[model samples]
Target: MLMLLAAGLLADPVPVYVIAGQSNAEGYGVPHAQLETIDDVTVVWPGRAQKEVGPLQAGWGANEKMIGPEYGFGQAMQRHHQSPVVLLKTAWGGKDVWCDFRSPSAGDFNWAEQQMKTREEREGRSRKVGAFFNAMVDNIEVGLHQAQVHLGRDDLELKGLVWFQGWNDYCQWPVEEAGSPCGRGIIERYPHNLKHMLCDLREALNDTTLPIVIGELGVHGSDVPKSRSGWALRAFRTAQSETASQLDHCCLAPTASFWDTQATDHWECHYNGSAKSYLRIGRTFALHLLALDALPDGQTLKWQASQKGLQAMLRRYPPKSGGLALWGSSIFRLWERAPAHFSEFEVTNVSFGGARSWETLHYADETLFPIQPSTIFYYCGSNDVNAGADAASIAERFRLFSELTRDRLPHTKIFFGAINRSPEKKERWAVVNEANQLVGSYCETQDGRTFVDLNQVLEADDGSTRQDMFLPDQLHLTERAYEGFARVMREALEQKVQSP
Candidate 1:
């Protein structure tokens, strides 16, 4: 290793992940003796008084007799990167993001202020508002110092953050009445506060694009009861998902799917104190972090995050192979009524917003190949053209896409949807038209490739772009526009595609 480092072959900086939240993040699950210590990963847990920095093992939980999500999370991180990993864990039991873990930008925590006053009166000193947040930042600095000493290297990158919280904000602060004060106070503010916390942490670390994984609060399990408490939990989970969706380089690991329903290890809110539940949650978090990290340059982070959630959905409810797949950018993603439009067949729209041709190719293996759809309506390259990619390059990407699809699903038919001449890209309309022409020429020569001219329905009688067909953004389509596009697709599929 020293020789490799001297030769600059092992110069990649070590990845340091920060894991912080409430009790669950602190850990409560039981650890078995068989759990191995990962040598490549170093955990700096400053939550304890000793502030130990060492190899990750089963015992680094809330106590020696228990384990937390960090155990599996650290191991998976090390395996995925195959490099030295450092974890900075600073979590407290029964803490809430709206108060105890609140960041500076989340505003003053009134409840914490009162508690601080009381504690200061009793004791000589007390932790101020946003105490946990402050401690977390302080611990991260300490962890980095310790990590540099432990590894005998100063090159460490804060790669990701793992957050497993929401119990106290959801369950502890129940919103019984519709539009209750409690609802607005904590539940409604949860998403905003969490986003602020992440942004604030990023600013502190000076890494704007730090990847984050939020563990879904699934204490009530998959089947949340039809009660006030259940409703609160559901809302909290939604808030967490929404925050992850809105942020770049962030994803949510749905722990409800990995719920210990049988209570194999034990039973209670902390995932039934089940090691299996914690392990699964940690692994899922690692997978999401990996997905975010693996996104190619210029590929949108939120789209990969969206793909992560969509993949989970596909796993839980696998789509039938040999169906109609509408894959592309926002044009197809915003078509929520796609199923009703293509009622004739099983249609799966795996499109995402702001997706370019290259991004589609990058994500095709994981998102498109799994279904191996019989036919596809590919609507992309609009973003690419807008991004200044030449017509030839965009067309070649489509050719590459077709080749990949042919290799995976030999008999699958592909329809290259012409890039829409939307008002948003009026300046690049010339490039869009040239790219469409190039792709059309290529598709005509291919065996199973067809070019569906969407501009036919999208344009008006005078050969001008129909402004009414577009939404206010001048990029996306309106309801009437989708109707016309659907009609064109239905006709093409019926006339061109033969039944299996």
Candidate 2:
């Protein structure tokens, strides 16, 4: 019995693909009369039947009478891999990324407070932010356990994720009606929200390089009508494609070509409940997953577009020598009026959104060499902390970055900006504090190096992250917070300049 158990443990793990999202992912497809079952593929759809593991076939969609893309995805995967596969599905109808499917990294939906309060008052139920996201995680866990049992091996691996969502976000009320904090609708922030969802999902699943295949929001098909809604659909589809393009190990499966005008069960958003569309989309998604291995390394491809954009921005506004340079992630990149704050110095911002420490090092040659700035105010590591890097590792990356900067510009003074604490990252505060301490200690070792505690001004009197200072997302800072940061940084710079 012991030897048999060991053999079972050593057996090759079954590859499981998690298929999740909103209505489209849940599948409104009318089941085919004669559905073929892929015996090689097992499906654990907790959303439909609790922990019931079965063969891949019809009745796995929203109900027993429907079919989802997983049907075709499993078919294609089985045909290509010629091995046992698991389709672990968790999906819900009418979900939106802005709130329902919001990821942890995306932070709270503060702008929806009034709406939530009203709903709670009326329905006596409060819709918490990231509700669906948490549910998805829990459901995936349940599915994974069932998969392990079905495969008779504890080593079952979740190989990929297929996401098909976006209609609700695209249908968000206009700025005038919603009156959001940033004056932006869900559609406007859809790309950023979607990216965070994917990244945070990966982190939660402990598979940072897991392949993701997104079904582009091609509901209206190729011949999009000329109207307000049509234009919005085009924009939304473009945003979906753009978001997929930025992330590594992720690809978009085009669905517009598969859109059938004659296959209407009801609403157009569900691709008219077309079995052909869902099946084709699933097959296309499988093809993309197969080809994902050929893509560039995650580290190299991550934020490649933002890195290239930074280079382009620098070319357009060439940085002059003997000036100040601001380096970091989206926090610094989004500060458009940074130059206005540093009036005494020619401030050039080379920061980019979603940048990690390694990216900073990756583009050092292009960002630092040309400028040779007299001073650089650095604000990074928040992303690194979120990416699960240890404090020591973050500090080491900073040291390496400083060394590279000092090598070319020896006289340059580098100031390390303290990573700010926020309500969103409250759980990870300990890690953030440790990273700040490690980086601060390293800065104290050098004469020209300094550690600026920008977080001080951004915090409330109670020492908690000031809710008002942060944007509705609860991660990025508001203009008031940036102003405080500018004031503190300016004072710090002046004091450092005057020191013997």
Pick out the ten consecutive residues of candidate 2 with the lowest summed lDDT.
175-184
Give the alpha carbon lDDT tens digit for every residue of 422-490 in model 1. 888888988998999999999878888888899988888899888789889888899998888888888
Residue 273 local lDDT, model 1? 84
The lDDT of each candidate is 0.78, 0.78
* True-vs-predicted CA distance for residue 111, candidate 1, Å: 11
Off by over 4 Å in 2: 1-11, 47-51, 108-125, 173-175, 178-184, 295-500
- Give the TM-score of each candidate: 0.62, 0.56
Each candidate's number of clashing pairs is 0, 0
Over 81-106, each residue of candidate 2 has an lDDT whose tens digit, in order, gives 67888988888888888778888787
Clashing pairs in 1: none
